[model samples]
Target: MNALARPFSVAAEARLSSADLPKPETLIRIEDLTKVYDPKEGPVLDGISLAIGKGDIHGIIGRSGAGKSTLVRCLNGLVAPTSGRVLVSGREISSLSGAPLRAARRDISMIFQHFSLLSSRTAAGNVALPLEVAGVEKNEIRRRIPELLELVGLSAKVDAYPSELSGGQKQRIGIARALALNPQVLLSDEATSALDPETTEQILALLKDINRRLGLTIVLITHEMDVVRQIASHVTVLEHGKLVESGPTFDVLAFPKSQVARSFLSSIVAHDLPRQVSERLRPSPAPGSSPVLRIVFAGQAAHEPVLAALVEQFRIRPNILHGRIDYIDDKPLGVLTLVAAGGTPTLPGVLAYLSSLGLHGEIVGHVL
Candidate 1:
């Protein structure tokens, strides 16, 4: 067996309990927020409540027309909520207007899906625009531009124009421009959607590096689960402008409770069995049928030899139908679908053994 397939010692299990960790400070809070564009169309954001912790890479995921764009607009005061409040750093963003709102927005900045850089401006000029608009002195703007470019690893491209730079480089310029105001929170609206897969991974890595180096809070809005799985520490699911699920990324990905979430995660994790395997499944057991088991391996359990144990201890032969292991936020998450032949009589004991090892096991169906 490989190192990852080795059995772990149950006595050495050391999962961290929630009570053991200090709670993170809340940087953004949405309380019963709603936005109505037209009475006939109903609210775009319906009674949504969510809290984003300081220094967290929070991901908001949903299908198109799910109100993701509307919620983000409400956060930075671009769109006012019909009712309820949005608090950022203890100040109500939903209520601010005019000069107050613009000033408050300095603490919150945004980047877009398209590289919103001016075609006429160079990389340094683009990064300097925000500072110039804020009325910072020429000397201060000159001093800050180099630092921002260096932060995004684009010092060499200082003189490059948007047309001259690649897509990833343009996004680096956009990110640097967003940070020009030294905002406390950064909002990304489908920032990586337009990039190719390799470029998307690079952009996500840059975002993760920025988050760690500067301790800046990031609110990432995307339709891709792989994007969230790559960097988000916390995740929230929205459906029809309502909050369907919210929690730590690992927990939500390991055992999703909502159908929308499950569907979204299908690409990242095996939420459904293969069509061939599923077609063979029967709701009830037959004379020579065997129980199909779906096992979820997470944390320490991902490295355990649970399948070997089934064969050794229970004499259960496992015919693995489908399985895959993926890492989320640097931790393992694995799902396996298998036929537990000759194990039906010991189903209860098999589940109990899995439970003792901190794994999730369910009898999905029977197959002959």
Candidate 2:
């Protein structure tokens, strides 16, 4: 490791949008983006267009065939787009090559889920490899390696080889190496799917902290909605290689307007009753039993005790049949299934009150 390997910081130049006013949420632009692997299937991307904002923790979500990997590769020039243009810092990335291409690649960093660290190299050595490739001096590599390890909380194990490190440790090394150039944008390709849930949370915390502290625009590609809810401020849903939905994380979760978006939201929303549950444990409806309602809470609404307020205001007895809470981006995000004891007529009043507090309530079934 050499002195020339010290943290290399590069600022991304902003490109003014056609909006005329400062381009908001348009740091990187993809217009009519298309990729074709085979002539028979046609283009995989299918003319997708998107704008990623600066300092945005953007998420691209979809199942296996969504052309996610191909899209990210196109952004970095690793995969060529058959048609359309990718604008990085407002310039056409598709037009860059040679030294300019290398320079452009440096502005963006990508982390793979596989933790692609060198098996023969120690953690520090693995991180220092990038700097070495750029002809950084030995003394600087040593300084930067320690700094990188410290950034990822692996300073204590800097000398440990990849084989000796745990999966989490290996990923920490991968993250450190990705940040070697201090890129303005970080690309995470399912970086947490390979880890256990607890380890996933740890990595998520680190990623969120880095995004906030460095103001780095992060593009996370994953199939898991949990991963998006954990750290992304904004989300983009891709299905069949097309854009299905894109907006703030909470908004999409609250009112999913697309089938793809709804599918992604089911784990956190009051989805349609399962067939087994619908058929089993259902008792005959009795007079004065109560009406059941499912309420979804998130963002500011989760902070308010709306359900408690409803009980007090409507004088309606409430019984909780099912409840769940999910934390998204370190904020309270959850779903609740409950049976409220009251007449059918009073249900409207209680629901309206809950809605006034920025919460959503859906009646699932009547309770006796």
Candidate 3:
């Protein structure tokens, strides 16, 4: 199996537990953050409050016009909030001005959706621009450029100009430039949206590796659910500039509470039944109909032979209509939609049994 699929094949005991994570440190805190460009248009960010722990790959996801871009800009001090505070490393970013704000931004670096490299500058020169702007000596710039290039696995492309590199290579250069100052927080604003699927995975893997090596706290801003599923330890959902849901990625994915969140996760997880299946479903059980159950298996329950147990213990045959199994942060999460024949009379006992196994079982509908 490939490296990505390997995680799904591993035993549940090998899964990383929440206790294995580092102790919480409030690295970035946003309290009641609101940003309004025009009085009549309403706030772009509406009373947002959140805390990002140190050494976390946190994803903030929303659709277009969801204020995702505005929020990231606020985090980096590019746009001042109308009401509320943005604190990074215990400094109030919204309160700072001019030189202090400029200096404060050194600790918070950002990579853009577009690889914002100068057309004339080579990879090494682009990486050196930040150091130069900070007034570092030429000798220091010379020494730092190669190290940054090497960190992003682009040391050999030091002399290649932006025009000469592919999209992925240009992104590597962009990542190198973002890390030039060794910032405390890295804001990725749709950094992988421009790349192909294969290249996106490569970039995400690289980012996860960087997070592991440097203990860097990353705020990933994007609309892609797969991006959050692949790398983010924690996820926050935004809709119409409001904070809808936020929590550990596995928990959110396995048991989403909001409509928007469920919609976003539907692509990766079977949050809703297929349209054709739904059309066939009835609200109440008919004479020859079977009850369709939606079962959610998370953590240890994912590896258990629950389906076999249902057949053996309850003497019910399960016909799977739709199902998907996915790993989030190396832990298995699965959702199965199946019809339980001859299980209507024993439904209560089956639900209790499933609950005993720490699984969620719900009767969605009945279908003949």
Candidate 4:
């Protein structure tokens, strides 16, 4: 079944209200940003407006060709926007050029998906290239290269060439090179998409450390949901080059308001019904059937005895179909699919029970 087919009224998982909008510690702000590749083809990025708070690991995700790359490139003035303003550290850079643009770009660093390292240069040599380009003193470059390489856990690989290094090590060299400029903002364009699962986790851990130790503002664009779920504090979704959804990663995952966002959450926040169960599923329960329900738990309710409470209060024992809990920003969020026999009459009350505890329970389909 399509995961986005059902909508749940979840006030607990709602986005931040406008009334409570205080002065946020914003480091990067894009206002009505639009990027058109071909005027005949329309805008690839359409009226995008979002904020990346200071020290935030902000993630932008979407399917391929959703304009994710264009959006991030615009942040650093790599792609000129067709219209709108981009402000980094409160300085508008959409129109700046020449030496001023170069000066501004030094504060914004980028780590590419493919480790953009020189095959001829060793890890330390690659890291020193940025400083050399900026014409820093040779003494300082020598002092800083080892420090930057050590920061990325590449102290031992300082003399290793890109061709000799593993994918993860090469990316680490790229990261070290990006950090050599000491930029406050770091942009990662699918940095982990090229790594294995275990290596991806390691790189993510290293990024989290960098964000913590250096208090860096990171903005990453990826097509992988796990990348955002693993590290991003805030997330934005793009659909056909339009801003479809944007919010805290947990809030967006827990309560997806758009079809594209809901589809993205299917594998992570929600599980699909098994084939046999789905084949038998009907809008109404059969004589000897059970009602299938999707129970969503987020925030504090994720730790509560939701299923046990339902059994006690409503006298309905749920036959678990599938369930999983995941941590986002160190908070527990979970979803469970279950079949409850002879419980349709009391479902409204059960849903109320779930809501009272900051959960949402929806009657999905009926099965025999």
Candidate 4, RMSD to the unseen true structure: 6.1
Put down candidate 1 lDDT per residue, 130-181, tens digits, no spaces.
8998889999999999999999999999999999999999999999999999
Q: Weakest 10 consecutive residues, lDDT, candidate 2?
A: 6-15
> Candidate 3: which pairs clash?
none
Which lDDT tens digits does candidate 3 get at residues 42-92?
988999999999998999999999999999999989999999999999999
Ranking by TM-score: 1, 3, 4, 2
Off by over 4 Å in 1: 1-17
Better of 1 and 4 by TM-score: 1
For model 4, what is the C-alpha lDDT against the true structure? 0.86
Candidate 2 lDDT, 1-368, residue by residue in tens: 35343212100111121245664657789999988899899778988998899988998999998998888888888888989999888767887888887888888889999988888888888998878877889998888888888999999998899899888988889999989988888999899989999999899889988998988899999999989988897898988889888887766776678988887877766544545444533354467566667788865567687767767887767776666676554445567776677646677887787788878887777755
Query: Could you give the C-alpha RMSD of every candidate to the true structure, in order shown?
Result: 3.2, 7.9, 2.3, 6.1
CA lDDT of each prediction against the hidden true structure:
0.92, 0.80, 0.92, 0.86
Error of 1 at 97 (Å): 0.6
RMSD of 1: 3.2
Which candidate would rank higher by lDDT, 1 or 4?
A: 1
lDDT per residue for candidate 4 within 33-99, as digits (tens), equals 9999999998899999999899888999999999999999999999999999999999898989889
TM values, all candidates: 0.95, 0.81, 0.94, 0.90
Native-to-model Cα distance after best TM-score fit, residue 45 in candidate 4, in Å: 0.7
lDDT of 1 at 150: 94
